[model samples]
Structures are given as structure tokens and as C-alpha cells.
Target chain A: MPYRYLEDIATADVAFEAWGKDLGELFAEAADATTNVMVEGLASIKRKETIDIELRNPELDILLYNFLNELVYLKDARRLLLRAYDITVEKEWPDFRLKAKVSGEAIDHARHRLKADVKAVTLHRLSVRETPEGWKATVVLDI
Target chain B: MRAQLAVPESIKKISDTVWEIPASYKPGMLVPARIYATEKLLKEMDAGVFDQVTNVACLPGIVNYALCMPDGHWGYGFPIGGVAAFDAERGVISPGGIGFDINCGMRLVLTNLTYEEVKPRLHELVDSLFYRIPTGVGSTGFIKLSFSEFEELVEQGSRWCLKKGLAWPEDLELTEERGCFAGADASKVSRKAVERGFDQVGTLGSGNHYCEIQVARPENIFDGNTARAFGFTVPDQVAVMFHCGSRGFGHQVATDYLQVFLDVMERKYGIKTLDRELACAPFNSPEGQAYFAAMKCAVNMAFANRQVILHRIREVFSNVFKKSPEALGMSMAYDVTHNTAKLEDHTINGRRTRLLVHRKGSTRAFGPGMEGIPERYRETGQPVIIGGSMETGSYLMAGLSTGAGAFYSTAHGSGRTMSRHQAKRTYRGEKLKRDMEARGIYVRSDTWGGLAEEAGAAYKNIDEVVEATELAGLSKRVVRLLPIGNIKG
Candidate 1:
């Protein structure tokens, strides 16, 4: 796993940090972390369905923030537990565009071991930064 | 491990239960920060509370002081239990101060039965409730609506329930804002928020949200007169209390506005906040007016959500006891919001002024004779429900005139002392459930891990938090409630 839960950050909610050698890997790890918070086992969420998502933002951090919230919105609106893959990010002079495919199955309580219901991704200590090794992002979820 | 931020040396004790950090503690602070807590609670507070509360003091147009209730804990933008009253004309409205779960609140309903009568069938009663009232993530409601109908429902709030025969006339009277917040323009809300919340009207969203069946013991009644006024006449009165909010609808509303405010707060307006989460817009600005209107839609949505849930509760009790809802004496005592920013009248520096008060993880405990309190509770003050951990107990309190200093705000719940990860590591949900059952409390949870994260030991001692509120003259304790049955989400 490229992401680890930060136990000491949020006293009532869940917080985690993810890292990767590139922005695509960093976004994927963060997406997985967000999904894992709501469902116990990642493998349990079989990829029976898939959706294509395209988003554009001038700022890289806001792009990641919006991407994570989109996943949350899908869970509530479509009842799908999704994980991102085939990720790609392109910086077009004034904006950054992200296009990816998210796959998972509709929520089945008997089959999936559910956990906390994440409300949204928060801006509290929210960050996406380029490190010497790669890229890193920290997120705090409102549960 | 996160290192604790040491208490600032400039902090001064104002009273046994009140502490103050002067404006000189930080630059650009509009007012001092006031914290209501005992010495022990003050010391036990997470370092984030101090940093966040002080950061709130620095926001533009804050009045008097930035206040935090005794149950304050570390949260995103404003510390949990944070309260700030801003000038309606000059101040700014930030989504962080109200929280993502717009109008996440508590509702207390009274019943005619006693604990002895309920004990024998508690399991059946709880199971029925857990099944009837959907729980956990991705759970939808029984009532379905089209996109346009959902828009109308958010605009009408709980009044929609009355038209559908889902709520009694008295339920609205007992609810805050009469179950409908004025200025809610459905047009201001986004289509995505409507889709997320339309089917979540009666759901109990996971993570600290629950619908519990509690009993008020004779020994726990502190103010018999006030307790009776709130309809706790039975010797071991049974009451149903639930904590929930607007669900995904409110989260989307908050998320949408947060980005809007972040975009315009500094560029369009000359406002700069220390924390990005505290991004805000001037109250009189176009962005601010739009967000406020949209926020009220979520507020109304939440009131409708709880109203529907209350109806389900009445249905479950009626079926279990083999009687009509009215025959079973199922009546709502009160419903109070914990997360909201409303325009209210308050005396600021001896002048009565209308202010937009933001309470995040706090409750409005309007005292005797205050406007908006129901006529039945006019003399005794508004009823405030403080939910505790399922394993411990909860409280029913009354607002005090003396709470005017904090804009009539008080603690909402037993604030968490440990993080969810820490609690999960310390206790097993299955074992905790078994232990609670052995102690005469029946609980049904959606997931064991979710149950483990909310262990009583993870939260502060409820008794002490209630004591601090009373000691600080914020609210008066009326009765303590111990859980007999609960449905955890």
C-alpha cells in the first residue's frame, strides 16, 4: 500500500497520507485510501462496473480534491464503491485536466464489509506537494 | 505521534470555568478567544482546539470573542464546539464554521411507557427500528421522489411531511425554525446535491450518528419541574433520541461553496484567512448571499430528514406495542440543531443586534423568554439534548439567560478523547456489543468496525462535560438518560 492512515491527526474523523513517484500514482493511492475508509477490504469491492471521469482545474491540489469528492459523490448518487485506474494528468498551460476510469460494484451489504461513511474530503491540512522522491498528498475526511 | 502544542502563557483564567486568550496573543485577531471549561478539561483539550479557536478570533467582523464550549475538540476549520457570532452586515460566513453536515442535530421524543415495561421487548423494539430506519453507508429511504419533487421538499422542509401525513402539526411546533428555515431557495441548490440527498431523508449516516432508545430514571432527574414540563412524567420514562444530519446533500452544498469562497475570498475581496479551510466571503457579497441561501436548503433538507425518521420511530413503537402512535403517547419534545449559521438577535455590547451565529458541533440553548423558543417551554427555556456514548448515557438540559454571553450556545455531545483508529485498536466491536447487552443495553450496528470506533472509552466523560456547562452558566441540567436500546449507523 502506498498510503497509510494518520491516527494522530484527526481526533474524531479519519486522516491519511499517500505518496507516489508521480501524480497519477499519488492520485490512485489517495483514491484507494478514501475508499478503504468506507469499506473494510479493498479486494472485496469487485470491479463489476466502471465509469469514465474527466475533470479540469488550474491548480493541481484542487484537482485532486475535486477528484476525491467526485468519488464520494458517486458512492452516494450511484451506490458504487469505486477505485481509480488508467490515470492520466495533463497540464494545459492555464489548466490541468484529469481523465481516468473508476471501477467497482454496486454496494451489496451482505457481500461487502462496510465501515465508516465518509461525508467529504476536507480542506483542513489538505495538500498535494512534489517531494524529492516523488509526490505526496494528505487528506482529512469528514466521516 | 503528533506532539501536543503547549498552552500559551498569555492565556488567563477568567473564572473557575472560563478562560480567555487575549487578542494580543496573535496579530490581526479581531477579538479575544473565550473558552468555557474547567481546569482539567482546559488542560485535556487537544492542541488543535487552541490553534483553531484562536484562528477563528482572527476572522473578519467577529463579535465580542470567539467562544468554544467545554466539549470542544479538534476539527477541520473551526474547532468542534466552536461558536462565533458575526455582524450580519459586515461579517463573513464560512462553511467551515457550520460543518459539512448542515443542521446535523438531535431530536428527543417522549413516550408513555417505562423501562420496566420496555425491558421485556427491548430486543424486538430495537430490531424493528434498525430495520425500519435504514443505517450505514449508501442506505436509501423508503420514500422515493423525482428531482423536482425533491426540490419542493427541500424548500418546504418538514412542512412537506405534514402535507403527506408523515408528521403531526405539533411536531413542527416543537422543531427549531418550525421545521422550515426561511430564505431557502431551491433554485440556489445544485442538481447534484438534490440527487445525493433526495433518497437519504430517513437514513442514519455512519460515523457517530445513531438512533437510541433511552430511559430517564427518577434518580437522574435534576429539575423535576422542567423535566415534567418536557413531558417526562412516567417514573422511568422512555424517550427516543437520534443524532443525524443532511447526509450527502449538505456535504455537497458545503463542498461547492467552499471552492467558490476559496476562489473569490482573496481575489475579489481583500480577506485573507490563516487556514484554507476557513475560506469565507463577506456577508453582503453576492457569493455570500448565494451560499447562505443554498446552505438553508440543506438546513431544511436535514429538518425534513429527521422529521421522516421520527415518523418511522413512531411507527415502530406503535407496531411493537400494538397501538396507534397517539395512543402510545409518541410525541416529539424538541429537535435542536448542532451545526448551523442562522441570523439571530442577540445583545452585543448592550445593544440588541441581529448577528449571523455559526455553531459547529454546538447547540443553541436559548434561555427563558428568548424569541423562537416554543410557547410550552417559554418560561423554563429551550430543551437541549446532549447525546453521550451509547455505552454511557445522555442528558436533557435547559438553556439559561446567562448563556447570552456565548450567544446562547452550549456543548452538543460527549466530545471524543481518542481518534477512531485508536478506539478501534483498543476495543473489539463484537465484545463491546456483548458487554453492553450484558449491562442491559441492546445495540444493533451496521458494521463491527464502525461499532468499535465509537466505544464509550473513546469519548470524554459526559458527566463532567455537562457539569462544566452548568458551572459556566450556559445551561441547566434537567435529567440524565441511560440507553436501553440503540441502532448505530
Candidate 2:
């Protein structure tokens, strides 16, 4: 697992920590963790559609939030059950940009077992820090 | 000076129902932090509630104490069950104060049918409801609106539902603000927010959101006059209650503003908050006003959302019992919003002033004399719908005169005692379903994992929370609602 659900948080929402050898992988893992929160068995999600997401923020943390929030928007707006397949993060000083390619299809209630509808990505105690291992981000999804 | 963000330990017991953390406990705090909970509840209260409430007290121009209701639980920025008011001229408005599910509220409907009358066919009724009322994640309503129509819905609130012939005229009368709040500017709402919300107006969003068919317990009615006022005339009278809000529309609006406020709050407005999630701008500033206008659109959208759901439910009942809506005597009891910010006049420090009151996971229990309540309920007071877990039961309550102490607010529900992950680990969803079935409660949910996360053990005892609210004179019980059928989203 590239990300792990954290139990230290409160009951009102879900918390998880994503890790990677770099920012790109960290973001990809984070996206997967978010999608996993809503439904399990990502392997069963046939790639009926591909969605391209791009986000720009001067700060890495805010950019991360926008990225995740964008996923939530796509899920609700297009009714897609998504799983991030690939991500690339480019950051230089005050600029952070991310482009992610995710694959999924319209939600089939008969197929996909919906777990929790993530309302949004909350910045409450949102954390994105660097360590020797590469990059780690702690986030919460307001479900 | 560095800000203190830790759980305060300097709290002083004010009464059995009140505790105060003085402003002196935190250097930047403009006011104290007061919690309306029993000693027992406080003993087990999450430390995050104390920290968040104190953070709220430190906000600029906060009036009096930042209060947390009896159901207070740890949440982002503002604790769930938190209530605070900011000055129009000086204070700021935080999106976090209302949370992402804007206008997340509850509305109860009363039916002439009694428990005994519906018991034999309860299975059929539940099945029909499950089939008729759209629920679960990705669920959509039958009614689809064009962009122009969507804009109209946002601007008109519940009135739009009535105009579309989806809601009864009596429904608006029993709603907060008569089902319409002023200052709704759909133009101010972002296109993305509007787009996201357009299709989700009637969906029951997931995570603790549900529509329940409950039977009124005759013995649970504490006030006959109030119970009669609410249309709960006899024991076992059935009621329909639902909890939801503006889906992705509200989320997008809140997300858009939180980013907007973050970029310019300190540099442009000189506003400072303890948490980034508490990002806010002065209430009078352009950014704040824009957010307020957009927030109003979200509020109206949520009201319309529930109104449409009520229409669908009425349709289902009509088909099942073979009675017209009027003949069934299906009337709304009252609709109450748990998350919102409204500018209202309140006497603060002797003078009456307009303050923007923000309540998150809290219910407004306006006393009998308040102007905001409906005429039929004017003498009894506002209906405070306290939703309980499907395993336990829910409550219908009425405001009391003395409830002004907590700014006319009470607990929203039995707050979470265990985390979702913990609950899932502790109980099996299938087992829970079987257990509830054995008790005659029919629960239909999309996923067993979802059901596991919302098991009864995950929440604090509803009875305790209601007892605290009543003992503190925040609200009095009208009747307890035992869930006969529940549709979990």
C-alpha cells in the first residue's frame, strides 16, 4: 500500500498518509487512497474513460488540495468512479504544477460498492512535508 | 506573540451544563470558550473540540464566548456543534464555520397514518421507498434542470420547488426562513459550483446522511402542547425525516473561497486565524460579501434539494398506500438547518446589533418569541430535529426560552464517539444488518462497508446527548422517533 489510513484522526472525517520516492508518486498514491475511500476493489474499475487533470498552485500543500478536490468534483459532476493511473508533479520555488491521468467509468451501483461519498478535501491540519525517504503528505477527506 | 493551539486545561466549571475557558487562558483570544455539555460528556470529549473552540474565540470581533453545543465533537477548524457570531464591521466569516456541506439541515414530515396502520405492510412500504427515493452515492433525481432553471432554483430556494409543483405550499411555512433566505445571488456563485450542484439537488449524499421512516413513541412525548403543535397528535404517528445538503455545489463554493481568502487574508485584510482551514475575510470586504452571496445560493440549493426529496417521498407513499397527498394528511413538521451563517439582530452587551451567527453541526433552537419561527409554531418554538443513528432512535424537540444562553443553539445529533475506521474494525456490516432486521428496522444501504462505518457503537449515546440538551434548557423533547425504515446514502 502506498498510503495508509490513519486512526489518529477524529470520527467526523477520514485521514490518510501518502508516501513516495518523489512528489509525483506521492500524489498518485494520494489519489488512489482518496478513490479507495469511496469504493474498494479498484481492480474491477474498467477503464471506460480517461480524465486528465492539471492544477497550478504556488504552494505544494494547496496544489495537493486542489488536485484532490478536482477528483471529488469529477466524481460528483461526471458521476465517474476514478483511480489515478499516473501523475507528474513539477515544483520550483513558488510554483507547483501537477498533471494527472486517471481512468474510470460512470458509477454502476450494481457493480461498484460505494463506501463513503467524499464531500471535499479539507485543509484542517493538512500536511505535506519532505523527509529523507522522499516525500510524505498527511491529508483528510471531509466525507 | 506565538499563538497557542493546544487543548486548554484552564477551564473552569460554571455549572452542570456549562464550562468556561477564560480569555486569559489564551493571549490572542478576544473572548472565552464556553461548552454546553454535561460533566460526563466533557470527561470523554475529544481534546480537539477544546482546541478548535478556543481557536474560534481568538477570531477577530467575535462576540461574547465561542460556544460548543452538547453534541460537540472534533472537526476541522470549527468543532462540530460549534457556534460563534462575528461583528459585521470587524469580524470575519470562515467557510470552515459552516463546513463543506453548506446548509446541511433536517426536515421532518408528519403523516396521518399510524404505526399500527402501517405495520403489517411495513416491508412493502420500505421496499417501495427504497425503490422510489433515490439514495446512495451517485444517485440522481428524476427531475433535471437546465442551466437557467438551475439558476432559478438557487435564487428561489424552496419556493422554486413549490413553483415546479414538487412541494406543498404548507411545506414552505414550516421551513426555516419560510424556506427562503434573502441575499441569494446566483450570479455570485461560480459556474463550477453551479455545475456540480445542478445534478445533485435531490441526491442523499453519503456519510451519516439518510432518510428515515420513524414511528413516534407515545411515551417519549415530553410536551403535549408542543407535540400537538408539531402535528404529532398520537402515539405511533409516522414521520419522514431526512438529512442532506448542497452536494458538490456547496463543496466547490467552499473550496473556491477557502483558496481565495487564503491568498489575501493577511496581506490585504490583516486578518489572522489559527488554522489555515479557518481562512476568512472581513464580512464587509468584497471577498467576504462575494462568499456570503455564493453561500446564500448554496443554502437555497440545499433547501430545494430536500424539498424535492419530500416530493419524491410523497409520491412513493401515495403509490404504496393508494391515497392522494392531501388525503394522507402529509404535512411538513419543520425544517431546521444545522450548518449556516445568517445575519440576525441579537442583544450583545446591552445594545441590539447584527451579528453573523455561524453554526456547524449545531441546531438553532430559537425560543417561542423569536420572529424567525413559523406562525403555527410561534407559540411552541422552533423544531430542533436531532437525528440519531439507525440503530438507536432520533428525536423531535422544541426550543425553550432559556436557550438564548447558547445563542439559541443545541446539539445537532449524538456526536461521534468512535472513528469510522474503528467502527468498521469492531463490527461486521452484514451482522449489523441482520441485527437491525431482527429488531424490525429495515435498512437499505449501498455498501456494507458504509454501513459498518456508521454502526451505532461509532456514536455517543443519543439519550445522553438529548438529556444534556433538555437538562440545560436548550430544548425540550416533543417525541422520540423509532426508525421503522431507513435509507442510508
Candidate 3:
């Protein structure tokens, strides 16, 4: 796993740190960590529906923030449990644009072993920075 | 990673139950931060409470002090049980202080039946409730509405339920603000928020949200007169209590405004906050007024959500008992909001002034003789519901006149001590279920993992927290409720 849940960062909510060789990989890992909080088994979510999400922000951290919150929005608005893949991030002038395809089926009580329902992605201690190895992002989700 | 913070050396013991971090301790602080906790609770508090509460003091136009109730814990921008009042004209309004779950609150319903009357059918009642009320991830409510209808419903709040015959007239009177928050302009709400919340009117969102059947035993009545006034007249009188909020609609509203505030707070308003989550705009700014109007829509949506759930609860109970809801004498005790920012009148510098109060994870416990409370409860005070962990029990409290110190606010629930990950690792859901069943509490949950995360041991002792609130003169205990049946979302 490229992301790990942080124990002391939050007591009433979930916090995790995700890293990647680059921004694209880091965004995917962070998305996975968020979905994993709600569903015990991500692999159990069948790719019956695909959602194409494109978001842009001048700030890399805000770009990731909007990306994750989009997934949470889909969970409620579309009733889909998704896993993001085929992700790409590119910097266009002063803006960072993120485009990804998220695939999953409508929530099935039989197939989906659900856990906590994440309310939203928060900006609490939210950060994205490049390290020696690659890129890392810290996120705290309000559950 | 940030190092763990220790108790600040600048903190002083204000009283046996109150601790203060002087404004001089931190630059830019306009007022001190006061914490209402017993010595033990204060000692055990996570360092974030100290850091966040003090940061709140730095907000411009803050009145008196930044306050945290006994259940205060680590939260994003403000501590979970944080409370602060800002000047109506000069102060700022931040989504961080109000929380994402806009009017996330608690509601108590009284039934004439006793525990003995409902004991044999406890399992059936809980199972029926669980099946009727959607739970867990991606669950939608039974009420489906077009986007336009949703807009109107939110503007109307619980009044929509009354018009639709889903709520009793008396229920509205018992709810705070009569179930509808004024100044809710749906046009101020974003389309994304409307889409996310349109279909979730009656859902019980997961993670610490639950519908419970509890009994108020004769022995646990702390204040008999107040309990009687609040409708706890019989020995082991059964009641229904549930905790939930506005769901996704509220989250989207907060998210949208946070971004809007982030863009203008410093650039346009020149307001700097210690945390990014504390993004705010002046209350009089266009952005702030727009967000406040939108926030009230979410608040009304939450009230409608709980009202619809109560309708379903009545249906399930009446069906099981083969009696009409009216025949069963089911009536609402009260509904209280935990996360909200409201404009109200308060005393500042020994004069009555209008202040905008922000209470995140804290309930407004307006004492007796307060103007806004229902006339029936004028003498006894507003009913305050403090939900405990399922395995232990909850409490029904009443506000006190002495609550003026904290602007008539108190703790909302048994604050979590253990992290969700730690709780899951420490407790097994199956074993917990069995143990609770042995103790005569029947529980139905969507998933075992979620159940494990809510183990009673994960939270502080509810009894102790309530005692601290009482000692701090925030609220007075009325009756302790023992759970017999629960539906966990």
C-alpha cells in the first residue's frame, strides 16, 4: 500500500498519508485510502459503472482536495462505490488539472461490506509536498 | 509529523471546573480561552484541544472567551465541543466553527409505554426500524424529491413534514427554532449541495449515528420535577433518541463556502487564520451573508431529516404494538442542534447585545425563563439530550440559568477518547454484540466493523462528563436513559 493511516493525527476522524513517485500516483493512492475507509474490501467493488472526473485548481493541494471530495460526492449523489485508476495530473500554466476514471457499481448490501460513511474531505493539516523520493500528501477526512 | 503538545504552562486554574489560557499566552488573541472540564478530563484532553481553542481566541471580534465543554476533543479547526460568540456586526463567520454537518443534532421522543411493555418485542422493534430507516454507506432516504422540491423543503424545514402529514403540530413546537431556521434562502445554496442532499431527507448516516430505544428508570431520575415536566412520568418510561445531521447537503455547503472564504478571507478581507480550515469572512461581507443564508438551509434540511425519521419511527412502533401513534401517546420531548451558528441576544459588557454564536459539537442549553424556548418548558428549561455510547447509556438534561457563562451551551455527546482505528483493534464486534445482548441491549447494525468502532470503551465515561457540565453550571442532569434496543447506522 502506498498510503498508511495515521494513528494520532485525528481521534474522532480518519487521517492518512499517501505518497507516490509523482503527483498522478500520489492522487490515486490518496483516493484509494479514502474509499478504503468506507468499504472494507475495495476489490469487492465491481466495475459496473465508470465516472469520468476532471477538476482543476491553481494549487496542487487544493486540486487533490477537490479530487477526493468529488469521490465523496459521487458516493452520495450517484450511490456508487468507486476506485480511481487511469489517473493523470498535468500543470497547465498556473493551474494543475486532474483527470481520472472512477469505476464501481451501485452499492449492493450483499457485496459491499460497508464501514464508516465519510462526510467530506477537510483542509485540516492538509498538505502536499515533494520529498527526496517522490511526492507526498497528508489528508484528514471527516467521517 | 508534529510533536505531541503538552499542557501549556500559561494555563491557569480558574476554578475547580474551569481552566483558562490567558490571551497574553498567544499573540493576536483578543480574549482568553476557557475550558470547562474536571481536572481529570482536562489532564486527559488531547493537545489539539488546547491548540485549537486558543487559536479560536485569535479570531477577530470574538466576545468574552473561547469555550470548550467537558467533552472537548481533537477536531480539525475548532475542538469538537468548542463554542464561541462573535459580534453580530464586526465578527466573522467561519464554516470551521459551525462544522460540516450543519445542524447535526439530537432528538428525544417520549412514549407512554414502559420497558416491561416493550421488552418482549424489543428485537422485532429494532429490526423493523433498521429495515425502514436506510443506514450505512450510500444509503438514500425514502423521501425522493425533485431538485426544486428539495429547495422548497429545505427552505420550509420541518414545516414541510407537517404539510405532508409526516409530523405532528406539537413536534414542531418542541424542536429548536420550531424546526425551521429563518433566513434560509435556497437560492444561496449551490447546485451541487442540492443534488447531494435532495434524496437523503430521512437517512441515518453511519459512524456514531444511531436510533435507540431507552428506558428512564425511576431510580435514575436526577431531578424529578424537571423529569416530569419533560414527560418522564412513569417508572422505566421508554423513549426514543437518535443522533444525525443534514448529511451530504450540509457537507457540500461547508466545502463550497470554505473554498469561497479561502479565496477572499486574506486577499479581500485581510483576515488571517492559524489553520486553513479556519477560513472565514466577515459576517457582513457578501460571501459571509451568502454562506450564512445557505447554512440555514442546511439547518432546516437537518430538522426535516430528523422529522421524517420520527415519522418512520412512529410508523414502526405503531405497527408493532397494533395501536395508532396517537393512541400510544407518542410525543416529542425536544430536538437540539449540536453544530450550528445562530444570531441571538446575549449580554456583553453588562448589556444585552445581539451576537452570532458558533457551537460545533455543543448543544444550546437555554435555561428556564429564556424567551425562545416553548412556553411549556419555560419553567423547566430547554431539554438537552446527551447521547452516550450504545453499550452504556445516554442522559436527558435541562439547561440552567447559570449557563449564561457559556452562552447556554453544553456537551453534545460522550466524547471519543480512542481513535476509530484503535477502537476497532481493541474490540471485536461479534463479542461486543454478544456482551451487549447479555446485558439486555439488542443492537442491529449494517456492518461489524462499524459496530466495533463504536464500542462504549472507545469513549469517555458519560456519567463523568455530565457531572462536569453540571458542576460547571452549564446544564443540570434530569434523567439517565438506559438503552434496550438500538439501530446503528
Candidate 4:
């Protein structure tokens, strides 16, 4: 399950309904509901940090905006307070490969919580699907 | 994406600073359709910005009114707070009325250190302004230039950053057109806009550029009475606000002048358009004076890319306040521009003329003893800069002569209200960066899907859209700032 809020002007809103026995746990629960909409006790941090994400696109909505602009350039230039514990996908030929693992707490605010600075990931109204209950995507963020 | 056009039962409310629309609602218009909003911001518009300001009062030398300010939206073909002028000896000059980000502006510096000496190194001055500023979307900068010095920086902007020592020489007497724009013409630009502006000079591109760090809100510094008419004075001091434009060589000179005004619209003037994205030409065409001299060389390459990002923000406040970027006083409290197209002069039914205008996403303003501003702001008139996202709050208005049918436009930001795919299916870039760091705002970005597509509930209420563009006279407020730290791109 992945869900987030705030919509109108400087927007953000995400939804997930995953049955993920494929498409890599619905793209790792939609990148952990898009980094839990900017860090909020991703189940109390203990994933012990793994970080390794790679993306190339042909079009899965520009491979989900190059996998969320590489988790927003590792949370705004490497202050890294992550989520999305795992994702492995490969669809070569013009490209699409992502391998991810993330943890948190380097942007400590009595322990991770900072939000919205998003500035691009638009080709306006982008979408992705592989339905019958498995993968779904709808992206837009130019905050 | 469901508005096949509707809002105009011949509008009429003319008494809250106007709102007309008529000319029988739509038959190749030619005048009548004024807006300026505030009946609660005209019930937050979106009948496709009143069908693109009545399809811009059916173009072809339009004059009188097509206005629309209270920060209107639905852009691309004029409607981001649109404005139109046209009549330099019989009108027309649309590159969608100057938008593809040509002179996308805003600049305010002020400093003298307060906020208790910059709140114990505000996170090492926002991580040294996010590692010496260089922002998103194919971003690149470290001063590169060179293509005959980016053609003398599109022809001397910010006086070529104070002759390359990079700023300070009284920051070009507080910018505006002084940052260059004496009708720029770097040989009417284009070698693919000088190879996409050779290495993006001092970049901060991407949609809605930024760079903030403000304060002055102790009830608007006791109600701006002590910005001491510009020299400011304490009250948590520190200011730096930013917003960018004219990047990617102003989107390849508005896509090479909207394909040279659609190949000279109807073979040298037979004009016809209900929207080929409003591609226009006439105003004594030669491709509209070479798209107004390549839109004044994308407004002097966005005033020399914000005078080299204000010389890398005075070298990050002269290395985090150790002082010496002229004793860190910083300077330049004016540098407006809200998208381009100039010529100006005004007066209209009292005669004067010399129009052209444009404005897209608006700004000019003018007023108080005008002489086209800049003589230390000719008695406080043109400053205007609006920008308000990154957790809302921004204003600093000034222009007032009832803005003469908008040659003195206004409203430039705090418009959109969701639609970056409805703010990425409704928020959560880490819970909007942990609720803008628990309201002390400290964002830095390259992406969290571009920080959840900038979530301050994705805009509007820039104090009720600059109080309905200063109660429709189109510009008046004065000071209000607020943000504390940001750096998005």
C-alpha cells in the first residue's frame, strides 16, 4: 500500500494498490510511496542502509521519471533519508534498469522528516500500466 | 482536460476593478474582455483562463483590454496572468506573447546579517547554497561562457557581471533594465541559441526556479515602514530570494520565434488564428522585426543569467559571512522582468502609443514618477517581483499609475493550483519534506520527484493573488517575504 497527499498548486498525491507477485513488488511499493512523501519514520529506520539505484528509460513513463529523478538525486544532493527497500527491474533495448535499496537518517531532524522541493518530472500527464492487478503508475511533479 | 470551453455569458461585473468579456463572446473578438479578478479571485478561474483571455481578444493589433492578472493560470499562449498591448503602428507580435521563459525574473538581495547572525550558520548557509548553486534539468554551470563570451553575454547584461570580476559596482544600480536590455541584439541570436547558451551560464533552470532565505515578517517588518525605504534595518535581517529564467537560451528563442511566426502567417499578412498556439506576425513584419530582435536576445540572456546568479550569491555570502563581498551588504534589491517584450511608452486614448508590451505571467507595474524607472527606483515605482512557493509567502510590489491598460502589468507567480499530474497523485515527497522541516522551511532539491512537485498545496493565495493584483489597479503592495531557506530547481 502506498498513499500520500497535498494537491493544488505546488502539488503531490500518490496512490498504490499492489498485489505485487510481479513487476517487482509494484515497483517497490511505488518507491515506498515516493519516499513516504519525504521521510516520516519509514517504520523506524532500521533497514541498515543499502542504496544502489540505476535507471534508463525507453518508456514506462520514462521509466517512472528515471525512477523518481533518482530518488530526487538521493534526497537533495546526498542528505539521504531514504525508503524503498528493494527493486530490481531490467528491460533492456533502448534501456530501463533499476536496482534499489535504501535506508534513512542523514538528514536528521530529531531523526528524518523534511519535505517538498520537487521541481521536475513532467512530460505532462504521464502514465504506466500492466494491470489485471499488478503494476500501475501515474506521475507528475514539477513543484 | 475536460474544459471544452465555457465561461462567458458576456461577463460584466465592472466594479471590483473590472471584469467584462463581451464583443459578443467570440466572433474573431477585436476588443472587450477585461479581468483583474477578486470577487474572491473571480471564483478561482479555470474555464481555461476564460478561454485564453477571450482567445486574447481576437488578436491582430489588439489594444484596450485583454488583461487578466490576479495570477491567472493555464499557460502557453498567454494566460499565466496574461497582458497584451500591440499597436506600434498597428499591432501583432506573438511568440505566445513572450513566454518560453524569456526573462523569467525576480531578484532581491538585501543582507546585513541578522536573524541572530544568520541563525548559527543556517545549516552552513543552506549547505553553502546547495554546493554553490547549479540546479536541475540538464543543469550545468561553473562559469563556462565563451562563444565570444556567450556573445558578450547576449550583449552586456548586468554590465557583463560588472566586467567579469563577477558583480558589485553597486550591483548595476539595483538592476531592472540596467541588467542589460537597451533592446539587446546579440546579432539577433541563434546558432541554436549559441549552442544552447554555451554551458548554461549560471544555471538554475527547470520549472519554477528558486533559491530563497528570507525573514522580514515580524508583521511584515512592522508593516514595511522600516525596510527603511530600501536600506532595510534589522528584524531578523537576511534576504536572498531568487527565481530564474531565460535558460536553454530562452527555450531556443521561443522555438525560433514560434517557427518565425508560423512562416510569416498567411504569406505576409492575411492573419487567421483561433490558436496555432497564437503564432502571430504583423507589427510591421519582417518576421515581426526579427521576433523583436530575437526577443531582445532573450532579454539579454536573462539579464546575464541573473548577473551570474548574483555572482554566485556574492560568493555564498562571501564565504558564509566571514565578510568581503563588499562587507557582505550584498545589495541589488530590484531586478524584476516577469517574462519579456518591451517598446513601452503607453497613454493610449490620450495618444502617446509606441506599444508592443506582451508580459506573459506579467510584472512591469511602473507608476510613481516613471521615466522608465532606475534612478535608485525613481521614487519607489518599479520593483514588483512576486514568486511564492516553497511553503508560501513572497511579495514586494510598487508600480501604480492605474497601470495604463497594462503596459504596467503585474502578477507573476503564486498561480498554479495543482496539475503536475495533480501534484503527483497528491503529495508525499517524504511527507512534503517532513512538512517543510516543521515550518522552518529548509528544502534543497534536484528531485523527490522534484520535491513532490513543490507542495505548498501547489499554489494560490499569494496573499489572495497579490490581493487580486492590488485590487485590480494591477500592482501596489510593498513588502512581505517570509520563507527561510530553499534551493529547488
Q: List the lowest-lDDT window of 10 residues for candidate 4 chain B.
A: B1-10
After the best TM-score superposition of candidate 4, give how far the Cα of residue B437 lies from its true spot, in angstroms: 37
The estimated TM-scores of all candidates read 0.99, 0.97, 0.99, 0.32
lDDT of 1 by residue, B159-229 (tens): 99999999999999999999999889988888889878888988989999999999999999999999999
lDDT of 3 by residue, B1-489 (tens): 221345678889999899999999888889999999998888878889999999999998899999999999988788999999999999999999999999999999999999999999999999999999998888899987999999999999999999999999999999999999999999999998998899999999999999999999999999999999999988989999999999999999999999999999999999999999889999999999999999999999999999999999999999999999888879999999999999999998889989999999999999999999999999998999999999999999999999998999999999999988999899988998999999999999998878998999999999999999999999999999999999998
Candidates arranged by DockQ, highest first: 1, 3, 2, 4
Superposed Cα deviation of residue A131, candidate 2 (Å):
1.9
Give every candidate's TM-score on chain A: 0.97, 0.94, 0.97, 0.29
Error of 1 at B313 (Å): 0.6
* Model 2 alpha-carbon drift over 4 Å, by segment: B1-7
The residue-level lDDT of candidate 2 at B397 comes to 93
**Reference-based TM-score, model 1:** 0.99
Query: Which docking band does candidate 3 fall into?
Result: high
The C-alpha lDDT values of all candidates are 0.93, 0.87, 0.94, 0.71
Local error of candidate 3 at residue A99 (angstroms)? 2.0
Q: After superposition, how far is residue B374 of candidate 3 from its true place, in Å?
A: 0.6
True contacts kept of each: 0.88, 0.78, 0.87, 0.11
